[model samples]
Target: MQLFSTHKLRNIQAQEQAIKKHAILVVDDEVANRKVITSILQYEFIVLEASNGVEAIELVQKHPNPESISMVISDQRMPHMSGVELLSQLAKIIPKSVRIIVSGYTDVESFIGSINKANIYKFIIKPFERADFLWTIERALENFELQQKHDTHLLSLEYIVAERTKELADKNIELEQAYKKLEDISLTDPLTQLKNRRYLDKHIDAKVGLSLKAFQNWQKDTTNPLPHNEQLTFFMLDLDNFKSVNDTYGHEYGDEVLKSIKPLLETLFRSSDIFIRLGGEEFLIVVRDINQTDAQILAERLRKTIKQYVFVVNSYTNFSITCSIGYVQYPYITEQPNALSWQQVVKLTDKALYLAKNNGRDAWVGLSHLNNNINENEITKLLDPDEILTQNNTINLVSNITLTIK
Candidate 1:
């Protein structure tokens, strides 16, 4: 290759003055080749030189902003590190640089192997013409500018997508909360602010399913201890004579008396236990993992609490109220003579409750051994399959569930 001619040299000097503001890096072990590459580009760009991959990496580290250098020209054949390897390292070091590989005819295959990794913009073999060399550099610079624009647009799109995704996720969370609120309102007793029968129809079935499973497990492993606290105690209670309060003092006074009892029930039972207001003047208390005595004690305390507390009728008149409670120990016959489901347990409790009502109210009665009447019909009822309703991945069985005391 020949040096730049006199007129060409003057033209190069003039071109350098008007060159656009961009940098180019040429890496080669041969000083002669570096000089040749630099001479052609020095007129049109800010030229940088590196003898090896190590030196190229050092230069990239020195310049904090790698985008300042736009093009990288690397010779493939080198001692410690090949040209392809150098460009590969430069990619990580300065990703914005458009890479070009300069190699001999024999080493063209070496660049092909790493072209995917190096993102080589052009491949120039040995003994290239000046016009082709200049043309390659010009195109590489143009591609670098186009790449910058693409990255900017891509970043803007990613930001917009991320923001939209977060907004949609937030909206889904709000919708779930609102749905829960509406569900609670539907299951609440308006007058007493207590969970109504709808809540019982679902929660009781889940608890009962657990009870049945435990009972089956106990039967299977009779020698082992009861599995995971399988006991459920139910207390059925009602105001002894709520109708008299309604008739004599009007329904408004009776309504107030029912609402007043909310705090008393909350205090009597545990926070974990579920409490339900069945309707006007009737309530149910559900207790779990308790002994027979503990169940009796809770029932007695509630009965006595109502009997003692003074209920203000009007501003002028104050009177006392009394409640009768009846609770039954679950799995009444643990010896397996009878497979007692929750429905049967409820029937036994209701029977005991009527016994309390029959014995002139204002008291609590526990189920005795005499009431354990296991007939064929009751056994059929216990084994019958309840209609299962699955909601939110939860299995809710709707049974032939009803309670009456007579």
Candidate 2:
């Protein structure tokens, strides 16, 4: 009989080795109960013994990771702490581990609380059936393995999502940089390095908002008498006879002349001023917080500087250039309302530019003189074709004069 029992035990041990060892921690103050439980599970599982809650807590802390501890089995009655208490502490350290309680006392309330709070997986009576105990432990180990697999899958998904998010963010930043580079190329004038007309149209609304805010602030200060000179000015300057330069000296020389004039204009004005190239031979200047006189002075100074600086195209060729300037100040005719619209101011300045071209082509003109002439009939007549120019001159008489001079 001894020889037969030894052979059976050896076969069981060989089968246990073929399967992976599941670790189990048993907590009990009674040495006999702990020995019995260990003996029952030792054949299939690697059993660890803990005499009380303190020892169980230390064991759980020592092997906190789920792969290290498969399950925990504790007795309800102990010296320092109860089974429920030990399970609750273990739940904090290793929440995924399976927990079971073996109790002789039939206190239903505390047992229910333990199930609710500590998430106990199973409960066994003091006198447990051998087959039932073995089946319960096998079931607990299976559940534990399933939970570990689920947790691993969740971790892998989180990692993949994090990596994908970072890649998208980097691509977004690259796209924004590419867009900004294209915008810079579009808004720049290649010859003069100044802002082109497209930039002006895109930002005009923001400029209008700023002007409105300034007008509102000026209106609010009623006690302080505002000066007549505190108003926005718009200056329109055009190069005189620019087409002649391109026709006489080449387009390249004309481009050089335009490039040279930009710096002189920028140096004569304040940094708060905005200067823009509104196409060939035309420029617009927006000077804020300046009165009509200061704007006119600035324009005249720019004109004089250009006239004095004789531009040399190359080693042997040189020429002189001139400019025509027209300006208009806001609040042209102040009414009882004490406010003027920006559109009206721009119209006045445009009219002033037309007058400056008609006056002599190389002087400055202010819109104050044309304020009264901005009536409905005059505006209608100005738009009429018959009032613009006539082309019925005698060419035969001019040819005769030219022949006599020759």
Candidate 3:
């Protein structure tokens, strides 16, 4: 630990003294008793003396700020009103102020009736040691400062909650607009709440057409557009051996496992991207306006996330699941954006998915691009056995299984 200089120590002492500057009220019918308590506390705190419970209340009311009085100490027996009654009324004016009562042994019987009613902090018996009295005052002031700090923190948290609520309301409005577009067609799956295959079948054509148009416009512009932003990428994900889940556990548990994938998909893709449940445990994600490299990174991340996730079926059963992913980018030949039909492109992506499953599960395979020299006939040959394309170097392959493709 480092030691502070004398100058620095003085500054620290000044800050502490500033924080302790709060008024404390002392109430008693006898002038001698009030003087004794005032002399002990006057050096550390702003001490105010009151002749009785009635004068203490009047003094507190006439003060410019009631909150400045951090604590109140009163004798149990007093004229005009009792200590408990005075503190109870002061509670309404300064609810956070710490209250303490000073009473004699004879006054113990009255305390049993009024302790909770006054919300007293602590009791000081008559003929107390000076040291113990000062210690109690220090503790009561600390409690007062803590309550003030807590109220300040609560106000800040309330403001943060209000801001977050407004943001959630705006997101709900966006969802409402999306729901209007789906009004004409029933597109949601009963389980998982992701779009069903029917939604994809109806919209994939328009999606592809729009991507092709954007690519063409990007190519013609003299001012170059960002690289890889024109590609339309798709990911095909299937849980490895998901049927066994239903067999070992019930179908209800399997349904829960499927529902869990919705959030995982949302985590990896943007809201603008389309997600589809192509029946069973297979999911399709269409991500637009992303580069090929970033799309490949997302596919690998999704595979790892599924592998590490713990699927809780019940209190007794918990298991981890893994998935295989295959992805492809549209305009397989960038020069010829429409060289292959959308159906043909999907077929190629499906082939990659099988490749990942065959290589061993919990991995991703991507068909990044095809050779520029390949003709229409050669393209057909590429599919009979995808290995031929890999052998001939007709297409680019990306996978976590190998650093190089054959």
Judging by TM-score against the true structure, name the best candidate: 2
lDDT agreement of model 1 with the native? 0.75
Question: TM-score-based ranking, best first?
Answer: 2, 1, 3
lDDT string, candidate 1, 1-406, tens digits: 9875999988977777657568888999999999999988887788889998899889889987787888889888888998878888888878878898887856545657768778777778888888899998898788778888899889989988988988998999899999899999998888998888888887887766666678777878779875435677888888989899998888988888888888888878778777789877888877877766677667778888889989886699999978877776566655442457666666656656665776678877776333324556645543343411111222111111122233
How well is each residue in 1-406 modelled by candidate 3, as lDDT tens digits? 8786999888988876675598889998988889999998887888888988778888999999988899998888887898999999999988788888898845566676567898888878888999999998898888778878898889889988988998899889888877876753478887899998888888887878878887677668738753357678888999999999999988999999999999988887889888999889998898888777888789889988899899987798899888998888886777667677666777778878888888777888888554654577866865665443252356777888862333
User: Could you tell me how far off, in angstroms, the CA of residue 22 lies in candidate 3 after the best superposition?
Assistant: 84
Q: Among these predicted structures, which one has the highest lDDT?
A: 3
Query: Each candidate's lDDT (Cα)?
Result: 0.75, 0.72, 0.82
TM-score of every candidate: 0.73, 0.74, 0.52
Model 2 / residue 34 / CA error / Å = 3.1
RMSD of each: 10.0, 8.8, 21.8
Ranking by lDDT: 3, 1, 2
Q: List model 2 lDDT by residue over 1-406, tens digit each.
A: 4446888898987887656478889999999999999989988888889999998888777765644777899998899798988998889887777999998977788778878877999878779888889999998888888888888989988988988898988899999998998897798788897778787677655655565655556667846555444466777788889999999999998999889867887788876666788889888777767665566677678768877889987798788988777677655442211334555566656555555566566766665422322445643443353443111221111110111110
